[model samples]
Target: MASDLNIARHGPQDGPPILLIHGAWHGAWCWDGLAPLLAAAGFRVLAPDLRGHGESPGRKHLRWTGIRQHVRDISALITGLDQPPIVIAHSMGGFIAQHLMARGVPMRGVAMLAALPHTGALPIALKTLWHHPRTFARILTRLSLYPMVADPADAARLFLDPATPAPEANRFHAKLQDESFRAFLDMVALALPGKPARPYPALVLAGADDALFPPKAEQRLARRLATTAQVLPGAPHDLMLSPHTETTARHILDWAATLPPGAKPPATAQTAPQT
Candidate 1:
């Protein structure tokens, strides 16, 4: 992230603060629906556009950035705050959040949404080719498998139920933007920082239909995090954009309800909840 990384905020200034970090190829707009929902709960929300995306400053010059770099930016933002806020990271952001806590940042709580937990590296072919000028030029000319960045129809069909209209997908797709090769390199490398995993209350959430990290994968990851995991049936990877997000948020908020800004995590989440 650049020195001018942006973490836009909303809601009451003194209310409990929650930071929502987006995943790859996504920006703060990813929380368009969820932010307002969090606000309605009388909570303050800060959704940052990481290094290369959204209105944030450093797009073209983020060559050196990887997962550790991004986590540093988030940690800096958290430290600058008047209070230690609960950090809720989604997908790749989940990895970043865990790394931040490991580095000894004062954290209220950490929640992972469909996060990647395995430390195994990305495919040799992908790691080698992600940033090749010729490779990216060729790949950019085509579609990506992730619906959040590419196909709106696919995104809608996957995220929404059969009753949802196409316009909803179009609206969501309008927020889509390009991601950096460096970001891919980071996740692929699993270069995120590591610690002995001081057990903070963690929540693992997923969508049953998430092609990226399906239910089984989420289960495996929860085991790694030593936390209980849940997947909303028929939901896709973009659970926040899904109609089920409010419910998912409440599931988390329910756990959040028991703890204050500086208090320890809930007993239910202190250890691992039943599967």
Candidate 2:
């Protein structure tokens, strides 16, 4: 059965559609800063809370599911669109995007921000822990066995810029949810498939100071996808909610403008919910 995902939409009804996928521990709410900017640029943006995150209502079963389930949910949403939508994914969401493209989902283009490379998140996590074992040890102790939510301070340290306001960081941390352990394992176990026969345009963006997927890692991912990696100076892993949100949004707008047109679904009468 297809899970009913909670979607947040923005922009004109007839405008080109773009789908924003959030990363681990985040829901559709993470796109709050970027969605309006894209909409104002004359594009319809759709950000959906993946199953078990935000208002999607599958939290109880999340521990047993993997990335494939998320791929299935997103595929269904895209299949329902008027035309293939451009995809912008972040963190683990980037991993999801890669799989979608590999499966031949018709996307006009894809933009990955601080995304987990095809190399997967496990290696990155292990590397980061190796460099800062004590810090991660403390963070790990706070996580529950099943659905694990990192402590707010740990999340802030790993994802926010040092200059970010305390309140803003707190707000972002408060929205963090538990991620699926099975999904994490799946990401580590899954291997990247050969490059797509019909390659689509791709953009890779990294936070210069991202503790998770650093610039070098993102660059490697770009190389694999045949695209260059762009870096947001001093930003952290969660670029969408960071101080550089506008700058990141602008870059996405510019890249999205260059893609060739594809399927565009007509505007619906349903109004976007308040953010």
Candidate 3:
């Protein structure tokens, strides 16, 4: 199952690998903009769709998939890498990464972008219920997570800057799909991955105007990582898709540069084999 994961690769294959993990309802497509930016900076990038998302298989079984399975799937990918790759995770992807860290998965470092806090996602769920009661109701009634972002306006308002043009927001919404109800419960504390097995370099970042997770949440996550959060002004939940993407990429690059040497590019660069 892990070998079958749909992975999008970029940059020089032998260059140090960096894995990009997207949040709930999102897939590797969310990193389409940022992956190239990182790749151009001399790092190989691998973005894999979690099971039931994007081009990954098992969409019909999404309802049964949970964060635990996601952790295993991703951990397998990391183990298969030529070397431990730096991990970049967003939103719920960040949550899954936490589980990996707690379980001692090998990685050079991690940068959590607008990730869920260790405290759990109950607050986020409550906020969603308050702001989008109809959508929330639909989610419960349908036993699926797609209702939360099924509407373009709702998706834009929840995940993008308010100033984003409607058409662009709609296009973004179009790419979103159903997420697992069990995964949402896992995030809300069916289990908490706790802190990392040991301290490793980490960076936490968030958007100031993000409607879902706030700067404070990022700060809490940073504290857990023994780091501080960087809150970008006017940014939204989807920093990779927002106008702040370049800035976000720059920050990640700068952080990666400061890390103790990890994976190194081969003398002759080549693209990695597709997963």
In terms of TM-score, which candidate is strongest? 3
Candidate maximizing lDDT:
3
Q: Local distance difference test, per candidate?
A: 0.68, 0.81, 0.87
In candidate 1 the C-alpha lDDT for residue 53 amounts to 72
lDDT of 2 by residue, 220-259 (tens): 9999889899988888998887578899998998898788
Distance from true location, Cα of 235 in model 2, Å? 1.3
Tens digits of per-residue lDDT for model 1, 50-128: 9867888777655446676677778777766666688888877876776776676667777777776655225322533
Candidate 3, residue 179: how far the Cα is off, in Å: 0.8
Query: What is candidate 2's TM-score against the reference?
Result: 0.88
What RMSD does each model have against the real structure? 6.7, 5.7, 4.8
C-alpha lDDT of residue 275 in model 1: 12
Record all residue pairs in model 3 with backbone atoms less than 3 Å apart, i.e. clashing: 13-270
Clash tally, candidates in order: 0, 2, 1
**Which of the two candidates, 2 or 3, achieves a greater TM-score against the reference?**
3
lDDT of 1: 0.68
By lDDT, rank the candidates, best first: 3, 2, 1
TM-score of each: 0.80, 0.88, 0.93
- Candidate 3 per-residue lDDT over residues 2-91, each given as its tens digit: 888899999999899999999998999999999999999999899999998999998989998989888888987887778789999999
Instruction: Report how far off residue 11 is in candidate 1 (Å).
Output: 1.5
